[model samples]
Every structure is written in C-alpha cells, then in structure tokens.
Target: MDNIFGDAAERLFAQTCTPDVIRRAEQGQPSGDAWRACEEAGFADALVLEDHGGAGLGLADALPVVVAAGRHLCPYPIAHTLLARAWLSRVQRPQASGAIALAPQGLAIDDGRVAGTNVAWARSADYVLAGIGGQTWLLPMQAARIEPNGVHGSLDGGVSWALADAERIDHVAPLETLAASAYTGLIAGAMDRVLAMTLDYANQRTQFGKPIGRFQAVQQQISEMAEQVWAARMAAQLAFQGEDGLPRPLLAALGKARASQAVPRVADIAHAVHGAIGVTAEHDLQLYTRRLREWRLAAGSESHWHDRIGADALASRSDALTYLRTALYGKETA
Candidate 1:
C-alpha cells in the first residue's frame, strides 16, 4: 500500500509536538487537546475507513506516525485510539467513541468491579474498551473508579476504572491482535528515538580529550544499540506487511516480544555510554526508556508474547515454510 503519511505529520511533530508537551503529559496534564489535535491532523484517522471519517491508510503508512508519537513519548492516547479503531472495524461497531487499552485476559465483570485493565489512558474519554474472555467490552469512562498506577516512578501513569456488572456490555473483537499491533508500533517508534538520541549524545559528549563516540568501546555500544533497533524495526515492519492474514495475536506477540527485549538493551547501552546523566529523570533518554519499559508490559509482557507466538507456531500444522513465507511476504508462491 502507498504511504499515507507525508511531510505534514513530521512538520507538526517538530513545531507543536515538542518534548515539553511530553513533559506535561508526564505530569498528568490534560492531553485531550493534543489528542484532538492529532485526530484532526489525520493520525487518529489513519486506520479508519473513509466512510468512518478516516484516510483508510494501511499499517505500512500508519507505522511512521506511531513511531513519531513514541519518539516524542507522547501521552496522548494514540495507541488506545488505534486499538479502538481496529476493534470497532473488526466488530463492525458504528459510532464507537472512546479510549481502549488491551487488558490482560479474563477481566472480572462482577458488581462494582474494574479488573484486568492495564495501561488504560482515557481518564476523561467518553468510553473505555476492554477485553474479557476473548471479548471486548465497552464501558463508560466515568463509571469506573480509576486508580493511579505508575512504572518505576516514571509517569507510566494509568487508572483502573471500576464498574458494576450491570453496566458492562459485551463487544467482542480480535483485541489481542489489535493490542499487540499498536503496542509493537509504539515501542518500535520509541526505539527509533532512543537510537537517534544516543548517537547524538555520543558525538556531543567529550571524554579523554576527544568525543566519546571516537572511542572503540563507545562505538561498539552504539553499534549494538543500532542493531537492536534494526531488529525491532524489522519485526515491526514485517508484522505490518502481513497485516491481512497474519493473526494479530501472533503478530502482536512477536512484535512486543522483540520490542520489549530490544528497547531495554538500546536504553542500557545509551545510558552506559552517556553515563550518570542519562539515568536522571531530567534527561530526555529516561523519558523514552521508562515509557519503553512500561509499554513492554502494557499489551502483554515479553513472556506473554513469547508463549503466544510459540503456541501459534506449534499449532500451525501446515507447512512451516509456507507459513513463514505467507507471514513475512504476505503470500506463498509454490
């Protein structure tokens, strides 16, 4: 498919979506304005069909926008929105408006219960989409009691909205796959930012009367970081290419597994080379790294994705080569 993203999104990122906006998001400031701004700018409408007021862009084109958002550590519920759009489309749900997070399997639907939710973003969203017993549920955002949660003291903040059983509605979709896809894209985007920032830091920071990048050890670290990003990006792109037939669950599983592994490696290398300054909250690297770690466990953790992918592969009784080719290239030619 053609790339739907042009220069406009990039320009917007440079002009309006600055690092400070991300800081505000970290501080629990209102991101509704930013979210609306992105929606108006065509990013939110990427996956939606033209009939649904979207550009009908495929995953290939939408990947870059996700990457950009991740790079900025954007706090706008971009991933949630993406998942919501996908879930609505698959289930043919019309006029569905809300923020959606891919919760862990088996959320409790008991009276006044709000469980199994993870990384939920819609603090003020009109609705919340959740997964329960392989089904998606739509709940009013205001109904649930939101509990503030964070990751490693970073602003990996989220709320657990509790709802009574009577208020629950069953709306099922391929949520596992949707969550995996969006999470993969978000982490890959953040990985790209990590690589860029680390590279610049290496070049700018001086040591022993020369740039740290000139040192062999530092260069090796940078090379390894780049390689990790490359691996993660390739996995993400391959997953995107097979968006049609590839099971979203399996694809998302692999995407997140690779990203969870790659992101921390990249961040560790960057911080090691950048030294103590890199670890501080004030530095931009921590912002990206913290979010990376948080997103890793959001849709599912590394172990979760790994087991899911392994199970799918093992359960596929068809020819392995055919499955592989169809998965990576979108087709299998005998």
Candidate 2:
C-alpha cells in the first residue's frame, strides 16, 4: 500500500536526473555522476535494510520506485541490488550497497572457470550477484569478462562478463527471479507513461480543424491503451503484494505477462497518435516507448510467461483454481 519513496525519488529525478542526462545515459554514455546521484537518492540502498543504510522496504514497497526509473529510462541498476541485497540478507551480507545486474541468459559454474553469465552490466557494478550450478554467488566484478557491446539496448554499450571467480555463497536466495519481477514492473510503469503521453498528444494535435482526440477512432485507441496499462498495473500490484515469501517465478511470470502485452499496445497507440513525430528522437515519447520495447523482451517475452502460466495451471489443476478462488474470496481452501 506504500506507494511513495517519500521525497527522495522525486527530488533525485527532478534535480539530478534531468532529461538531457537521461538521454545521454540512454544513448550509451555511462555517467558516474548520474549513477552516484542515484546512490544519493537511496536507490542503491533500497535492498539494503536500515541497519545497512537501506530504506528497509520490501519488493511491494520498492516496485513503484523501480517503475518510476523505468518510465524515465534511468540507466541505473536499482532492481538488481533489490534482488541481490534482499537475498544476501539471509547470509549476513546485510551491509552491501552497490548496483547489481542480472544476466538474461544466466551464468555457468565450472571448475576453476566461471560460466553462466551472459550479457552482464558489471562495468558499472561495484559488486555482483551471480547464479552458478543451482547456487548463488557474490563475487568481485573483476572476475567477469565485461565484454564490450554497442549501445543497441539499455546496457549502455558496456561490456558483459562471465563469473570467473564466482564464489558460492550459501543460504542466500537467488535474486534472478526477483529481478525479473522488478524489471517487468518497470516496463509496465513505462507503458503507463507512454499511453498518457499519447493521449495528451491526441488531445492537443488538431487536424481538419478539430482535435484528433475528439474523433471516436482516436478515442478507441486511447481507451484500449488505458485498459492495457491498467491490466499491467494490476498484474504488477499482484506481483508486489504477493511477495510474502512466495516463489519469485510465479509473480515474475505474472508481471512479465501483463507488461509484455501492454507495452506493444501502448507503443502502437503512442506512434499512431503522434504520427511521424513519435518515432523521432526529439520527442521524449520515443524514449519511453523505445525502452518499453527493449525491456519488454529483455527479461522474458509474452510467450515465455504464457508457457510458464500454462505449466503452473497444468501442474495444479483444481488446486490452482482454488488459489484463484481464494484470491477472489480472501481465504485459501484446503
């Protein structure tokens, strides 16, 4: 129910993360200053508890903050730390404060050689949380390759690395799943921003001596976009609210499902409303919509979530229906 990160996030976004700075970050230029401002904003500490200099908020509380960052396309790793530090708490790494980046393809752990990390953002990360051989590891960033790639996506032209010195840390929960959910939440939030901007454009842009939004066809598109955004928002809320020791896969899948569907719909509406200008870099709408597309397929696509949901449904059958029923009725059945 706590939707705000106080005034910290707002102040940081307004003062430190200006539109120009964000554009630079999105264009693949890493700004240590902006990243540091993010640290100052308490984003890096979202996962770390108060005792460890964090806000001590759980995933539900932190979702909005992550979503806001996604809307702005802020190129910092808030969600990664959220996953890593929360898991590290179990193993007494409660004092950790740094950016974390989850590998989309996962890492491999082998003897004397680290594997399983593909497409990492370790260049900007002070520390790393890695997955290896069904175990989690906290390792120094130097151990990974940090392979250099262009700024085609959000990685910012940074190099990715494999976990060469992935030291297994026992008892720490894996942050991969949580990271997935947060990433999905962020995309969903960005979609909301995109739709709103598109609606505003439709309202203001006049053609044939009338505002485009006054037309029924334009209104229908805007309405559909709104519905999609609302559905994704609900899904994100479900994922956040159900983070009470629940398996991350389920919540993550749900969040991803909602977002993946909503983003494209939102993007289409935005472009349609803005016409030729929407695709231009000059408009901020493109930034949000572009990142929405990138992030939509980054973690997992719609096909991935649908398969996951289908698997869950098949495995539980009536028990799953009971769970759904419980959610509707506010009580779990035996």
- Report clash pairs, candidate 1: 67-189, 112-164, 144-162, 145-162, 147-160, 177-248
Per-candidate RMSD vs. true structure?
3.0, 3.2
TM-score, prediction 1? 0.87
Candidate 2: list runs displaced more than 4 Å. 1-7, 109-124, 142-144, 148-153, 156-164, 243-248, 326-334
The CA lDDT at 163 in model 2 is 41
The TM-scores, one per candidate, come to 0.87, 0.85
Q: Rate the local accuracy (lDDT) of all candidates.
A: 0.66, 0.66
TM-score for predicted model 2 compared with the true structure:
0.85
Off by over 4 Å in 1: 1-6, 104-106, 122-126, 150-171, 242-248, 317-323, 326-334
Provide the lowest-lDDT 10-residue window in model 1: 150-159
